[model samples]
Target: MDGVILNVVTWSDMYYLDTWGRRQFMILGAVVMSICMLIVGMLSRTEGRPAYDPTLYKVNFDFANIVSAGTAVLALRYLYVASFAIS
Candidate 1:
């Protein structure tokens, strides 16, 4: 996902830079990446959380905080890579 996003962004980034300029893209990427990373970081600080209910619960991502957090982190990671690559 990281590689793919990076590669895809790289191809179009030149156009974006040409059209919008690097300063704006850099700032946009920086802001997006910072927000993403901050969310992921906050999520990481919370560990050992139960994903299921105390009753009639099964181990699953659907009921777990990790599901959202993990997804957020994965998304953030991709954004981070893309932003880094773009700049």
Candidate 2:
């Protein structure tokens, strides 16, 4: 690597880097990924969706179910965070 300072390297680095910043990134990424999955999952129901055809996006799942599950998991994580913050 060059002499330039990189932001982060390992998971432990995340621990000392910025707790809130890492949490925010994780939360945001999860949300965006979940949304994208939901959209693609819905499109799968239709015969043809231009953005992702069978040849492109090849994931199989019930969109609503996945969204519900993802939300629940993330929410639980955030709940723990909230609990910690309150205490």
Candidate 3:
């Protein structure tokens, strides 16, 4: 979930940078990311789980799967770009 959100934000930032400029994209990305972090932090804290207990927290397999998939896609993208650039 977080990874998906981050990917969306990243793509949105790229679009903004292309359409508006670097300054606007930087500001927008910073603000959006900060808000997301804050929301996640608050939600985690409100779950009432002890900090020392790993088992108390619910495991989000969906989030993990999405993150892994996103990572693989990004890695492939980088490899393609690098290969093309080298040629």
Q: Highest lDDT: give the candidate number.
A: 1
TM-scores of all predicted structures: 0.67, 0.34, 0.42
User: On residues 43-80, what C-alpha lDDT tens digit does candidate 3 reach at each position?
Assistant: 44543232354686644322232465445444544443
Say which prediction, candidate 1 or candidate 2, comes out ahead on lDDT: 1
Tell me the lDDT of candidate 1: 0.72
Q: Please list the Cα RMSD from the true structure of every candidate, rounded to 1 decimal place.
A: 7.8, 12.6, 11.6
Please tell me which predicted candidate would have the highest TM-score against the true structure: 1
Which rank order by TM-score, best down to worst? 1, 3, 2
Prediction 2 TM-score vs. true: 0.34
Model 3 — which ten-residue stretch has the worst lDDT?
A: 78-87
lDDT of each residue in 1-87, candidate 1, tens digit only: 777888898998887688878788888878877887787666666642536655866643331545766777677788788887787
lDDT, model 3, position 75: 52
* Model 2: per-residue Cα lDDT over 1-87, one tens digit each: 211112222433456437556566566556655665555445545433234347756654333534655455445444444323322
Preferred candidate (TM-score higher): 1 or 2: 1
For model 1, state the Cα shift of residue 23 in Å: 0.9
Model 1 / residue 46 / CA error / Å? 2.0
